[model samples]
Target: MFPIIFVSLGPGEAELITLKGLKALQNADCIFCPETPARDGRLLSRAADIMLQLDIPADHIYRFSLPMSKQRMDALNAYDQVYAAALSLHHAGKRVAIVAEGDTGFYSSIHYIYEKLQAGGTPVEQIAGIPAFIAAGARGGLHIASQEERLTVIPGITTADEIEQLIQSRSTVVIMKLSQCTDEVHRCIRLHPEYDYHYFENVGTPQEKYICDTRQIEALHFPYFSLIIIRHNSF
Candidate 1:
């Protein structure tokens, strides 16, 4: 039986992929990557870009449009389709690698697929990568958490009330996927001005930008990959 490896490509930079991940990609018979809809109606795959940067041949790479909806039924269907494709390849005696952005276990779609594949008795290996929040903190000169302080990572799609409560508890907060709920996040920050906050977009890439003032978050257009870090009394 062939092995399936889940490779994390890091936050955004092509060079940030781990040596282990690179080796896995190099050895794999086929690589599967998630593709997003581009502005021109074409699909764009970050994993493909990483492969190109590493000089991997295009013939070994394949792109799949993974579902990213919040709906339950749509999400289930998407996972099933992707898993079936991977399983088909594995049964063909192919070593497969699924490339994901950021850490495979941290709010990544790869996690769902990994769990499903494992439950079906398929052996899977996970390759770790740098999470976006960590990269954001480093770029903004902010420390996410220390000693006894609690760190909470919340998806921006979470309700405003939950976010308000989390911020009130004074935990170091990291809000991810901010593109969908920027207004709600802005309100949460406005309610808690005592904390120092920073907005980071496309960290470690050429488009990377850091905003120290919470006020600026509302004016700018946030990408789906953007994150916000709120530091409570740690300035």
Candidate 2:
């Protein structure tokens, strides 16, 4: 039975892919990468770019246009579609690697397909990769958490009231899917003046940018790939 591998392409950099993930991509019979629709109608795939950066050429690469939607039904439908296609490829004796950006288990929609494949008793494997928040922390040379330090990850669509409560805790907080919560972000900005905000976008890629200026951070609308790390001033 051919195995379906879920390969995590850490952040956006090819170099950050673990040795195991690199090997998985190189040895796979085919790779399925999630691509986004560009403004020009061309498909843009970060996974494919990383694959090329690693000199891992492929002939049977599949680009599935996955929607970056906040709605659950829209995302589930896309994952189901991809899962069906991947299963078809796997049954054909192909080692299928469905690549996802960032850690597979960390706020990624790819896990939907992974769980679906697992429940169906299909042979599946997950290759871990560096999460975007971790890379952002590393990029700034800032330690996110220390011994006995509490670390909490706030998901994308958390309510503003919930976010306010999370920030009140004496812990390091990582907020992902920043694009979805514009109002919550503005609320957080207005409410929390004591915390330090580290904003990072397109981390690990050439387009990476991070800022500590709260005024600047509040001025711009956050993008889909953006993440905000919040830590108390004392920490």
Candidate 3:
């Protein structure tokens, strides 16, 4: 049976890749990576450096763009293309590896590919890796959650109103994808002057940057691979 291995690239650190993820990539017959054309740039490119260290051939690495606009038909069609590519490769007796950041199971495109493959009765395998939350916590010296604290994780793209509401109610909130919604997130942080907030970007990358200030950070440059932790006090 051909194995479709979903490999997590980790939070922009080569050492963060699991031993299993590295082994699979070394033996992979075909590799698939996701692409995003945000004005800032692509997060997967950081993973590409790992692939380079392994000296994988350029042709062996293929990237498919994830639809970004509000075109559902085109988006679904793109997903179908990903499904078709993997399916075709699996049928050819090749072990396929799909790469994602953090872990494949957490907000990874591999989930979409996996569902489609399962529907077609394909054998699949998953290799987990470190998540961004862990790395963010480590970088900022913040503990993620305690037994008594309810962890509320919100995507950074949430509307200003929704973010304001969450910050008002939740004592501990972790926000992901802060690079895109910096201004809104900045505003939300200001509403609570007494709390401690940490804004970390590129959590484990060489270019990682962070700030632990309640004051609104204006035009604070942040990488797309980021997480924000807001905690009121000890839980």
Best by TM-score: 2
Q: Which pairs of residues collide in model 1? A: none
Cα shift from native, residue 232, model 1 (Å): 2.0
Pairwise lDDT winner, candidates 2 and 3: 2
Tens digits of lDDT, candidate 1, 158-215: 7656776776686777889988887777777677776777899888777889998767
Model 2 steric clash pairs = none
Per-residue lDDT of candidate 2, residues 96-117 (tens digit): 8988889888777789999999
Ranking by TM-score: 2, 1, 3
**Candidate 3 residues 17-127, lDDT tens each?**
888898899888888876667677744465667677667776788778766655667667777887899888988898888888898888665588777877778988888
Off by over 4 Å in 3: 38-44, 70-75, 157-171, 216-223
C-alpha positional error of residue 173 in candidate 1 after TM-score superposition, expressed in Å: 0.4
Worst 10 residues of 2 by lDDT: 160-169
* lDDT-better candidate, 1 vs 2: 2
> Which of the two, 2 or 3, has more TM-score?
2
Where does model 2 exceed 4 Å of error?
A: none
Q: State candidate 2's TM-score.
A: 0.93
